[model samples]
Target chain A: MAKEKTSALHENKGVSQPKDTNTRAIKNIRTKRNTKLNTKALVASILKSDTVALSRAITLIESNHPSHIKQANAIIKACLPYANQSIRIGVTGVPGVGKSTFIEAFGKYLTSKGKRVAVLAIDPSSSLSKGSILGDKTRMEALVKDEHAFIRPSSSGDSLGGVARKTRESIILCEAAGFDVIIIETVGVGQSETTVHSMVDFFLLLKLAGAGDELQGIKRGIMEMADAVVINKADGDTLKHAQLAKVEFNKALQLYPIKASRWKPKVMLCSALQNEGIDSVWKLISDYIAITSKNHYFEKKRQEQNKFWLIQTIETQLKSHFFNRPDIKKELEQQLELIKANETTPFAAADYLLNL
Target chain B: MAKEKTSALHENKGVSQPKDTNTRAIKNIRTKRNTKLNTKALVASILKSDTVALSRAITLIESNHPSHIKQANAIIKACLPYANQSIRIGVTGVPGVGKSTFIEAFGKYLTSKGKRVAVLAIDPSSSLSKGSILGDKTRMEALVKDEHAFIRPSSSGDSLGGVARKTRESIILCEAAGFDVIIIETVGVGQSETTVHSMVDFFLLLKLAGAGDELQGIKRGIMEMADAVVINKADGDTLKHAQLAKVEFNKALQLYPIKASRWKPKVMLCSALQNEGIDSVWKLISDYIAITSKNHYFEKKRQEQNKFWLIQTIETQLKSHFFNRPDIKKELEQQLELIKANETTPFAAADYLLNL
Candidate 1:
């Protein structure tokens, strides 16, 4: 009776939805791997297409430690010159819309064409969802096992801005590692879609044809951000429905002014499971690149994206510094009450906080 | 010049596009009217429904001088208790879509029904466009003379955020002056439409019956923000076209999910010049208010709006302070060059600036 069994849960032996408790081991590994690595060697290895070095550099980038951050910055700067030649495309869709399968087929197509492919994700909800984006090794087992492909889950962060910045930086690392095509995937939530759109050369939206109401669950402004909208699962009973959705989407796209890229967004039908329509999707993207390059829109758009990111980054930091102050957080609640009670104007309340 | 006299241009006596040289008179008037007025007295006068006091308060808010800002803040805080009772409606359209005429007809209709109306504008481009919004005193002759109606031109500022803040404060003073209906007019430009949409209770979009492309000039997110889409000038030759346009617009609006207010935006035909269909617009708005109030979305949206404005103001100020610093401004340009040349990542650049 006195020799009762100790709880395995307290000893970390019980494995049920485990997280947050084992970060010590991971932190130790990060420190051991990163302590002696200089930025120049990392850049040289990545430039030579060393996959292990590429993965380690990304780990340094995804690290929140100050020393890792300094190293990641130097490596990113050194690798930037080698990063501009790859085609960085973004793919987005809802949760159950077969993103993993479509991505597998598409990556395999690219790899079979003698091209190296890299798949990265920008899931802001990854932490809560347990890194679900590209989390399961079996989801795209073929793509993962392909020697010419690299897949990485999203970087966990307290904010989408932080996650997006990390993902955006990781793109440069992948490109420098000699990936011919880099696919950044995001779920079809609003802010993340906009973030991915700003960073990518082309954006592809995947949809499932509905019984009716083809627009359901589609966030506002998403249909406009898309360079091409693909109706997935068009091979079975949903073929006719997918055709109808194509018409509906075309009409909806017509409602928007033509993009500055001078490329009209298209609606295509695809069957990822059957591996149908995958070639046409690649062709559509290639045609877009060719046309935009001829008109000089492709280079101009990349320059614009760079400027946009720089400005956006500064603004986010400025706001974050102010909002995270201990006194400001305490005072904001009191001001909100005053605002609801009609005793202070919002601008006046803001002034009070700024002065504090 | 023949007599060796000074030229009219040099003497500021020419009848040309004169600006930036004749502000003395206006500044003197502002100082004379506002220097001695206290916040409590101004609030009392506004509560007594003094239009002159309300106008003066708005003029103070529009001033950029430090003393004027201090006084304006006090007055706005004092007037807060009397605000939040009015129904604010935002009307927006392209330049040629006849906004002035529609607003005039709508304002007259409200006054005729014994409702006190106040019309305000939020044109960020007012400084460049010479205050075209409500600038022409003759544009709404009947409504301008209506005893129950008050119309004010947009407040001019170098930034949209500045102008929007001024207009938002003016809204409180107008409500305190006993106006039951406040109409905020904004041109269908992207940022201004969003700013107006955030401040008002209802957003009305005015559209022309296009030759074929009905959604031609509508901005990307404007349609989603609209509570109602009115096909203006639906008389004479365009009458049949307006009917077809109504069907087109109805289809377009249906594409958007229902709003948080649970209101389905409607498409109606109106001839502002002929004063037709004006009452229906009012009836539609009343119906919207009734439903939203029943669902408590009306109150909830306003509360959310207040909290949103509070945070927005703080963020805007934080950004402005950071960007306006002389050292930061100089370094930002240099950082942009580095970013374009791919010598640094945006996040790293931002951190450098933040530390500086």
Candidate 2:
């Protein structure tokens, strides 16, 4: 595997047994001497499935420094040829559904099956925590110790769109790093889930069996986006409730029309703590990927997602440019006040502003 | 009632009455006669609840002739001060759901209770029909003759956003004309329902008891916008099905989180043909309005809707401006191809285009 070569290269770094070792690869002298890191060398190592090089490249992508922009784009362009090979899955649930534990167990299960798994998160409100609140080594201890598993926290402090874009780019790097399966986890509180949903091939919504109370904290319109709903923590006293919730959710899902993909969303019950049903969840995903791939919906959806992201990126940038203009900003405030006072219609105000 | 004056004015026209009558009002000079139809006179008459002036002004608003633009804006400006006084309810249902018959019966019921009613529609695909397929005069035979009821088909031959904007402006005209209840009707398919939902104070989704087949043909994410879902055609043998559907929908709704209105959406069974449960549907809207108004959510939602429209209009216009540019259009096509080939990331392409 590509990863084994990366590991061998790292181990033979300074005390090289062969003369070709130093000449065969770019030296790590740049890293040790605090000089500019070689972008080509990083990309080469990342393509070889070097975890350290991949992580450093992602940091470059996330950096705000203008000088890093060119190098980051270069690294991404180099990795693009090797990206999009992995199946991307997005998992979302409100806080307290034991997402970290679920991901840990799921990641460990996949690693045991010899599948390289990469877990990334999208948390819009985690600027204070910097990255994944659940990504602490203590939270995912087993996965943290696994050589076949990689878990990265959410990028902090930027806009949700910014973080989402970075996470999307990072997915490309991880895939180039030879991760076979990529999982994106987002909190269901705000708009992050929708962002993650747009970038992934399949979306899984996690839920608890709190009956009606479980739906309270979740935002509206998200349930319809789920490709599957898994009732988590279904053990002991909650087992019956989880079973009932699964039945109820299936019934509710039947009320929705089949999506264009012709894939009917399923509802399942699981106990991540006990490691029960995790295999079934993985099987469901594998089955979904197999069917979608056979039917060509998988590639079609990825192309569509790519197009959507292009249009969305342009729109976001255009909007930011318009709103950030000092002149428009002042005029917009006045227009908002006039609208609040009912002195003018929004259409008329928009007309005036656009003309201005 | 203000409608009485409108009725009297039509009756008094062309009569050899007192000499002061001529001086009391401005003549309709723009009627190709030697006299000028005073704009102020039209505004005054509309404010006096003159249905003739109201209908003419709405026609002006709907006209695409460049000459009509100034007059339409003037009319909307005149009506703005008196608008926002009525409760705007949006009604939507798929074909065969009996929306027209329901609206006729509901309008008649309201007029019988001494409340003037105005019904309008939003049909994006109706450019082919040039208006509401349901608003055919023969279909709404009773409403066509009812003095206290005003029914207008959709504004035809425009985009959904254009039609929705016109209809929203028409709502203001109706309110200013003393129609105390305004209802905007739309087909459930496509994007019309969402446009109507955004403009109205309350949204009611009409459905037929199709077991589960009813959800087909309707787009996803619309059901979540409904303030109430009414099972229509609940008469004769279908009554049992409608009742069952009501219960099923109620259960399905429970799976969704409560809306921001903090009001639970109700499912009611109504037979527009038999006029059964029609009053109860009205009661639901009244209760909704009463509760939302008391809690100030009514006004808050209206303000938010206003703000939303303002930003949406600006964004839509900005997008059209960007996409319509020949330079940008050429670049966009090339960028789309590159994205399809995975030769470039969306963010990078967007940056390239925006700088252009």
Best by DockQ: 1
TM-score of each: 0.80, 0.77
Which pairs clash inside model 2? B29-B35, B29-B36, B29-B37, B30-B37
Model 1 deviation from the true structure expressed as Cα RMSD, one decimal place: 10.6
Candidate 2 CAPRI assessment class: acceptable
* Cα RMSD (angstroms) for every candidate in the order listed: 10.6, 13.4
Q: Model 2 compared with the native: what TM-score?
A: 0.77
Write model 1 residue lDDT over B171-286, tens digit each, in one string. Answer: 99999899999999998774999999999999999999868778765777889999999999999999988999999889998877778888999999999999999999999999
Per-chain TM-score of candidate 1, chain B: 0.86
The interface RMSD values of the models, given in order, are 1.6, 1.7
lDDT of each: 0.88, 0.85
What is the DockQ score of candidate 1, to 2 decimals? Answer: 0.54
DockQ of each: 0.54, 0.47
- Per-residue CA lDDT of model 2 for A203-321, tens digit only, reads 99999998554545546678789999999999999998898888788887887778877888999989999999999999999889988999899999998888888889999999999
